[model samples]
Target chain A: MSLAAFLTPESHSTCRPVGASVLGQRLESPADIADITRRVWQDSMNVLQAPHIYSGVEMALWDLLGKRYEEPVYRLLGYDKAFAKQPYVVVPFAAVPEQTFERMRHIRQAGYRAVKTGWSGFGHGNIASDLSQLAAAREGLGADARLFIDAARIWGCDVVAAKRYCPLFDQFSIEWVEEPFDPTALNAYADFAAHHGRMRLAAGENIHSIQQAQQLLNIAGIGVIQIDCGRVGGIGAAKEIAQYADLRCARYINHTYTSHLALSASLQAYAGLERQDLCEYPMDPTSLSWSICREHLLVGGDGEVTIPNAPGLGITISLDDLQRYVVDLEIRIGRTTLYRTPSIR
Target chain B: MSLAAFLTPESHSTCRPVGASVLGQRLESPADIADITRRVWQDSMNVLQAPHIYSGVEMALWDLLGKRYEEPVYRLLGYDKAFAKQPYVVVPFAAVPEQTFERMRHIRQAGYRAVKTGWSGFGHGNIASDLSQLAAAREGLGADARLFIDAARIWGCDVVAAKRYCPLFDQFSIEWVEEPFDPTALNAYADFAAHHGRMRLAAGENIHSIQQAQQLLNIAGIGVIQIDCGRVGGIGAAKEIAQYADLRCARYINHTYTSHLALSASLQAYAGLERQDLCEYPMDPTSLSWSICREHLLVGGDGEVTIPNAPGLGITISLDDLQRYVVDLEIRIGRTTLYRTPSIR
Candidate 1:
């Protein structure tokens, strides 16, 4: 077989390229990927005991497997059907409620299908002010648009408080209330679900793996199982969770308030899922998603973006862009450091 | 209202004596109990931000309410009918398999009707080793006895691992498999349940409050919702969870690997439910349950204990035994320290 190439710019040149030769095994199938990844994980655990350290390696393996199969990673993972992604833009909280309302309008005008706002001012302070902001956002986005409220885990609403306050958002036509309480408080989540049966409760962005996703979705009344590929291990794990969510009849919303790389990865995974109805597209103006990649994977006028078809993540990394934004850089070969930028003094 | 009495010996005198006067209210009804507990909980959260700190106070409130009503706390909690207690004794993991076998025999001979063992010898070991111990216990206890396996969250088996290992226990007539993975691994638990469709999965003892229990019970495939009153806030919270579990058609098994006081407390909560089928009675010889209370809440030959009918928590507090067993004591009066034991010389 011809050499499978991956470019590494001068800054991160020491990082090893992944291929059959580098892995010391022929990357012929998913079984081979599993065998190598498991061994790599075992090796890491025996030495460093850091399971998270292997995620990047595992994701890269999936990319290579995609290239090897001459297909998108989703299709390689057996998702043959096409998915039309209807993206939702998150309207991050502004100190001024009116400014937040304006941003919600901008999000709708950006051709986004849906919008999400936060609960910064909801649980405490002037709840009426928060309610008004939600109402304004709903009004700005128009009646046909979907609106979601993300408490972002800062809203310290207990089940009782959540029950008392969540329904107040219903008048604005809130699609779902996300993370109204401590995520660990699953029962509290259930109570909120029970009390606000009319409104949907969504979670799982902070959830760590496919297994945790399974548990969260198994929660009888949970309506949405939010998936962020970066937080939930990697694309491999996300696909597994998305499949499980489909089986449970829960909505799979790719949580994409992450970097361009992660959002692209999530898009690839979402492309193959049957329930790819809506996804998070960090459409917030201040987000770094647009600037990080050489080529923009922009959300079009209809609120959808084409899944990248290029081999291995389908986006070119701009070395200048990485250097401009990165706080520090280091390159290592085994235990020896090949290079590292000097600390900014 | 007249002053109510409580006996707090010198050793545990640091523990507050609960009364209507101390609570600064007439503890005349369950409504009053609720009012006080909520206030106490709010005050603690405001000052200390630790909700767990108020559980003892909340439990004491239940005791006060029970005393005022001249009934068991369960009856005060709205369980109006008779319930016959059927108990299961937990046979915690023994060092040796044969020793475990002997302990199981002892448990049956001790008049317990059902038995529970641990996962130390199961999951990873040759399946037969765990199976033999279970079979030996089953044979000793007779075919009619119910057997359970408590992994105690040590098995570390994922849903895949659980699916592979759980079915092997079916021949031994295992009642349920308890927490084969980290309790936080809810997805793993769900997956295990999904795979082992024939076997029942039980959990919730480590759960801290009624909300969590409700969440765990709300999880699909969990057949048994185990409640340890001490861990689950108080008898008040346990009653709430038991009620929810009942509605979900899940079995309510009181978890009692605790002191006699907590065991008695759990029994009170257990005795009120229509599903008062099995409560855990730690039958290990080394357990303090055998000698803590002045009068033993003895298990009959048929493996049951009558609910303590005395006012409050029905069992007599053995002062001498408490003093002997207690490692240290402290008492506080509002912000002032009333007493604290001297450090060991």
Candidate 2:
């Protein structure tokens, strides 16, 4: 799952990389990173998986460039300094309303100014059950805290089905309804956006390319553009979308639900954009995800999280933890070894 | 590289597929095929590679369905009969105009009523060179032959560069200009289409899903929508695009270059549309590609190709050739064998 790209001053190259896990290639400029992204995209022609695989390689490229230049990734991305982002406690909805209420109450008690509950059978059931869940979440989070609903695309382009929850969204004071339809369903998104009440439509997390992100902004009529650096061809593409969204006068936010390394990578893209203040924070990550990085971007007393000023992604990887969680893999074609697990060290 | 899906009446299943190579699952209806496609898409979240891998599976599903019902795949798709398609002889531009002329002449002498020359340094060079190539192609093909130019997307998104060839396109009576830019560069396509004269803009060979194909027709403003059945989620998706194009008053054509099996699969989608007669025929495919299928869709005396009236794809796979070309592959994670090459038999 973790992929790294190493760079050296000599042996300049274009397409030769070690394997999917490690990009043993040279890094020259930002264009080289874009070239690599395009090459990977063209090679596989899988917008989603190619970006997912190369996102790590892209992060590694930026990390290498940042380290070589003795600057943080944000600074390398033309940012003056990293700004603090208001972290929203992201939690999946529980099976029942009471559980959801308790989960929201705990998040509110933890001093989070915003909370997002998504994708644990939240919108899959009847409207009454969804209403109950939304009511519980709002009541538990208190009237002042911002509440966000992540439908997780349960409606799947059913504008009418999604519209039924508009009353719940408005009644609960939901800031935005995220991904109520398939990410690529632009027409459905536009239709829903036109009819939805006060709550704004938000999407773009599933987008892998900048063209697609631009399409979402241009055609989907969504207010907020959420990008996951780990999935959207890494930080460069995310930054491009961020700039495009800024020009379009749309809100931008990072979507991270994995390790702190990923969180830092996601944050660095729009780290200097003061207006895009909100960021997703993984409240209940798996043990492996939590242990992958040595340092975490912790929420401050002001309920804001800031990226590290250190070089690269500004997060340290735990070699021991990586080794502990590594799954030894090998792929062979005939007698030739196509790929083998690279040494963690 | 080949993937297969097997269905049995007794073992009713949803998601349990054997591996990337074979699907040991049941498919009850067209909805099941769609369900599998959606599941594969959701699993990888890849529009391209996921469809690519699933395409063979999809073809297998259709093949299975057609076999079980004693009908051709087109019939299963609700087509009354497979219509004849004008087979266009597809060739690559030689290094020089003389060589291009010779190739086109040979295709014309062989009784191909249409010719398409692409890639191999056609539009990548100066406009004069491209014009000479186009002129040579037209001169060699004679005045009656339908001439097409496949730019092979060498210009990327440079509308100005592509615009420089409009005069040549019009002067040569080129039927269409194929893929002057990247497949996803819809805006560039639209911009180029706006200014380009006479010759229609053609694209969509790289499209993986029906959504993208629809986007090309709806936004790119292209007149011809070309789909590769092997890549665009197989026959069903191709049919959907074909039907969509027909409704939009745009011409639909199949883009196949690999094997006759693929050509047959591609042809089935639009076999009922008589007006959409053009079909890509590989004039010089790789030996292995030619050897994969026992029965080839050869151009008839009328200079047209037609699908077989037999059940399923009608083109039989050469099992011996498959065994001959098979490369034993194995993917192991720790001590568990995740995948091994399935038997050709």
lDDT of each: 0.62, 0.77
Q: What is the two-chain DockQ of model 1?
A: 0.04
lDDT of 2: 0.77
Q: Would you list the clashing residue pairs of candidate 2?
A: none
Which lDDT tens digits does candidate 2 get at residues A1-345?
Answer: 112121111111222232432354457877777777666654444222355666777888898888888899999899998889988878778889999899889888888879888777777757788888888888888999998888877887789889888888889899899999878788888898888831388998877778788888777788799998977878998999998888778889888877888888998999988888888887554678888788899888777897899988878889998899887777677887756889998
Alpha-carbon runs more than 4 Å astray in model 2: A1-25, A38-48, A197-199, B1-25, B41-48, B197-199
Candidate 1 local Cα displacement, residue B105, angstroms? 2.9
lDDT of 2 at B99: 92
User: What value does the TM-score of chain B take for model 1?
Assistant: 0.80
Segments of candidate 1 deviating more than 4 angstroms: A1-177, A180-345, B1-28, B32-56, B154-160, B163-168, B181-200, B209-219, B247-249, B284-292, B325-345
